[model samples]
Target: MNRGLRIAVVLAGGLAALMLAGCGKHETAQATAVPAPAMKPAPPTPIEVKKEEVGGPTWDPEWDKIVELALPPAMLSGQVPHDVKRFCPAFYGMAEDDKRAFWAYFFQALAGAEAGLEPTVQAKHAQPEMAVKDEVTGRPGRTSGLLQLTYEDQKRYGCDFDWERDKQLKVGDPDRTILQPKNNLECGVKILDKQIIEKHKALLSASGYWSTLRPGTVSYRVFAKQMTNVPAACAVHNARKTVDGTR
Candidate 1:
């Protein structure tokens, strides 16, 4: 080939190599421009309990701490009962720690009304409907514990109460799973979750598991009084549907 033709061929090959390098650089720049995916927020810390609302011959102040630790992660999540936010709008804006504190207060109030915060108190009902026999003990069905749960709750709500082992122990024994404050309160959370979240029942429905949560019942009055002192962060100013009974 002629010299001019040789020079033209070399220049063309060099230009092609530069064009390929430019395309490679463009691809690398595009890859580096992508943004990272967003991260989910961290879960809330455990609640710190300070006091109780109920005092009785059987009430134990230590049960308050058990209620605090017994609360599950879901309870502190956004899935909290709408009635709570409806009655206390401030609950929507409160920090995770404050929300946890409010729920701890709520259970304390409930235990106060249901069993006077008595972890081992057993109550028997004479009303024909509620006077059923205890399936585990073959005796009359009686509500027991800080939340007044029965051995049947183990089947109904998958509670941790073990009557077979507990029967060997004397009554009011702290070793009884039903009488343990943490077990009783955790089971209470599960029951309330099913009622309000799964069953879509009102928090204060007459058909609720606990009569203390049912509005207009004499026991509900006791629960209402305890709610009067919910965490200040709740900002429950108006008489909406609350322990104060706007609900």
Candidate 2:
């Protein structure tokens, strides 16, 4: 009877050891089968801000914020020395809200879309005059100053002050009203405003102006093409209607 009891006790101990070993194996298998969680991507860095000159209105912090959004790095890099007050007196007439809105439109949005607020003058006749007359009409190619404002545009735009004769200047002299940032901006705005008002079309919408210009492969078209989105800056002015009812 004592021998029988000893054998039974040994059998019980063996069974308990087997059960523990099986439990350990199950835990290891479960750990290996389970998957790890995925990591998330990092966010992009913000653009750095710097102090620079711009022509239009006095530097209001609020207007500066609008400029920051509208103007690109290239425009900011080309600083204009003239005070905003010198050129854009129209800003003074506007309500505070409207003034801020116009700055965004004229300076940030339209200026960016146009040939930029700075002038680009092309001198067609840098060479000595050969005195050749045109078959269609008598005209010489030699001209200078912004917009390549041939003698024709100069007369039309009333910029008769001779930058060429006075300074023997190339492109981008401050005396050239065309090169003046505020003047350039004002001229560009006036041109667009004239077109919109005369045509009596709702020019504020992206599709509206895009359709009117019907931009081909010209340089102006290319500039407009780059500015695909309608600037949020213009919304404050909210003068979308034309003299006529065609939207």
Candidate 3:
């Protein structure tokens, strides 16, 4: 071979080797490279709830004193006076301590407003027959008793039970009189229970009445008025811690 030809062949061979080395490096990089790991979805969050609150007056020990002072003289005369406690067992559950306190306070206020807890023997002018008479004479008046059921009241709550004729046969048993303490109280509580059930459509504890009847409302006033001497009676009863303490 000539010197020029040999030199050209040698340069071509060197160029070919360099190109093959570059190809090998590219293939090695592709094989060694790694893909990123697959991503995971995040977890879900939780929900929260809120509770409701109730409100009312705390039980007071001295509330009984108010009831005792408000009871009728007849109640203190060693006789069962006509008042709310005598009839409405529900009233005894007005507070957390005992329902009797509520009954006593209620009747105490009622007795103070009405005839002082003496056995209301004589049918007052507020009696149904008499009130109707008074109405015709242009003198409308409210009736008496722990419930204070008026003349018109007889038409509504007269005979849920005929305790007067059924329980006792006295011509005019003051205790059993429709407007007297025992009868009036029984009728009143029954009426209230019926009203609550009718309105709410459920059975209620004694405390339920106070909770349902908001203070300063007409219902509270009417209830308080009907249950006169209740505070005084409660005070007397609590002080004695005996049912017969008033007597």
Candidate 4:
């Protein structure tokens, strides 16, 4: 009689424990479940701000301002392109004083005359027949850059001028690089220096390299007008290193 009673009691106690644990699990499920929010997440913004600013030239207020102020707008029609084909080697190799005073005016005039002061636009010859074709694309490529650096000039100067548009877009593309005035203007001044010093053309103002250098042409007038403020030593006759270069 005692054994039977004890077994029945143990079975009832086990059943009660199981019922209690099932109720606890139901309550825990109710407590943990959550409903979703009504509103959708907002879209990300398109604006992107870089931590560091891309580098550009700290244009010299001293000489740069003078060059900026001097050039007249009427002169820049791309009719007379600046002779920037050799600008990279010529301008970079000149004396500092010559660079500041005379050469800047000379080159800027050519650039203004050639490209109308925009680096991206190519300079075109006023005469339709005289335009030179691009070596790469076989399309007639116009002169480009602040110096009216031509397609020919790019090859002549050893600057980057890729024939493939995609390749040029990636490397040594003058259209992109010339936009940087630091590179364009710097190379322009040097290229002009080459005409007088290296080529022995003897005339910064009258070099046969650019028709603008010759007197009586509209290009020369722009050159003369811009030089009104330049020192007297910075003239066509004195542009060369020696008189022997005049030939």
Candidate 5:
């Protein structure tokens, strides 16, 4: 009960209170020091097409009718812009034949670049990612036929390639649906339709099925070289207007 003893006890209590306050302040500082979430990168912007023309050498005589038949109405109307970065101008006031011919040239050019127009050609990829196991065939992935399509495309895009029937046949047999020119090109048409019409992607998107359509790749130059003969009606050099302006 002495005054000195009481003073010592009070000092100890105040020291404990000070220590608790310091700890609380330290915790508050730590809470405030947490970093903010990082921002994601922007998507690639689409490029607008300024002109369309073809100058490639003539394709096989037979492919013209096949491509014309496979083309959907939207492509002829210029509603499906294959050049996604460059906006496609609607083919207003143009003849159906010119539009059809232009698309035929485009496909012929694509076929030439993809497989040298060889229906039975099968290409094995060198890249580690592309060489992964095929989903349908359960073998190393290989791009087959004129459009260089994979067996997995049958499941992914409802393509006509039948792996079960194909496995029984020889590698280059024309009897295989995937190796057939008509089936392969038709499958390509469906894939392009999904990209342009269903997904609203550019004809030449980074994530497109065909590497030949992707810009800045070595294969893209091959495809570009084949575009020398696009129909004249698509190239309105003096129009001086955007796709929106065309509307």
Candidate 6:
């Protein structure tokens, strides 16, 4: 009887060990399992922020954020912003072969100061425009586009792009002809040319016109210090219109 009891005890111990082993295996499997990472679009490469001091309206953090989103390194290059057909229509229209390159660089730098190459920028807080009717929905819209052209500029340039004519508008719905890249650029270039090339009012007006370029102003100092490319930009500005003044 004692021998039988010993055998039964051994059997029970073996069963317990088997149960524990099974549990260990289950735990191991659970521990090792992992979920796969979810798929997402690769984010755009980041541009380093220029940290410099300048005086003007208090810096809006939003402008930096907006610029980072819109302006890529490629867009800021003189080649891209200086292009004759696509980006800078102003360059193409320049009759003077002598100043074309300088003009392109000047405009590129100005773009950095303005909308950061964002064609659709509205300058919502600064320059308000006449509320024009949208031809499709009859909804009222205001000034927007590349160069942030204002309602005054639209009328000034005599740009009338009826939405009905453009089936392939960039935003899918036409904002207006003034807000379109081509129209806004045409107006903006003509104004720029008239200001410098035609009127010869001096390029200083360009720097003075935009607070960002005004010297000794907080914005100017900030741009000078912060924007790594300021020297290149200044070189272009000075080369083109130094007698007019520069930051």
Q: Best lDDT goes to which candidate?
A: 1
TM-score per prediction, in order, is 0.68, 0.35, 0.30, 0.45, 0.67, 0.39
lDDT of 2 by residue, 67-161 (tens): 32333222222121113222233333434443334334333333333333224443344334323432222456533322233333444444334
Query: What are the Cα lDDT values of the candidates?
Result: 0.68, 0.35, 0.38, 0.44, 0.66, 0.40
Best-to-worst order by lDDT is 1, 5, 4, 6, 3, 2
Span of ten consecutive residues with least summed lDDT in model 2: 41-50
Off by more than 4 A, model 4: 1-99, 126-129, 160-175, 204-207, 231-247
How many angstroms is residue 20 displaced in model 1 relative to the true structure, after the best TM-score fit?
60
Across 45-108, the per-residue lDDT of candidate 5 in tens digits comes to 1110111122222233345556666767776554666452132133454577766666666676
Query: Which parts of model 2 have CA positions greater than 4 angstroms off?
Result: 1-151, 159-167, 199-212, 218-221, 225-247
Scored against the true structure, residue 182 in model 2 reaches a CA lDDT of 42
- Per-structure clash totals for the candidates: 1, 1, 31, 10, 12, 9
- Which candidate ranks first by TM-score, i.e. highest? 1
TM-score of candidate 1 against the unseen true structure: 0.68
**Location of the lowest summed lDDT over 10 successive residues in candidate 3:** 43-52
RMSD of candidate 6 to the truth, in angstroms, is 23.4
Q: For residues 1-247, could you state the per-residue lDDT of candidate 6 as single tens digits?
A: 2323543554466557545655646766757754321111111111112211222222222222222222222232333323222212333233232123333334434544555545556543432322555344344544455455555553444544454544355542435565555665555555554444444443333353344455567655433433333213134344445445653
Q: Mind giving the per-residue lDDT tens digits that candidate 4 earns over 1-247? A: 2323443554465457546655746776756754321111111111100111332221122224234333232222122233422221233343444344333445444555555544565455656644657674465735556566544555665544434443347323444654445555655544544555456454545545565567778876665554333334334344443445755
Ten-residue segment with the worst summed lDDT in candidate 1?
A: 39-48
TM-score of candidate 4 versus the correct structure, residues matched by position: 0.45
lDDT of 3 by residue, 16-131 (tens): 75466557466777577543222111111010000011222111222233333333333222232223344343333333223433434444343333333333433345435334
TM-score of 5: 0.67
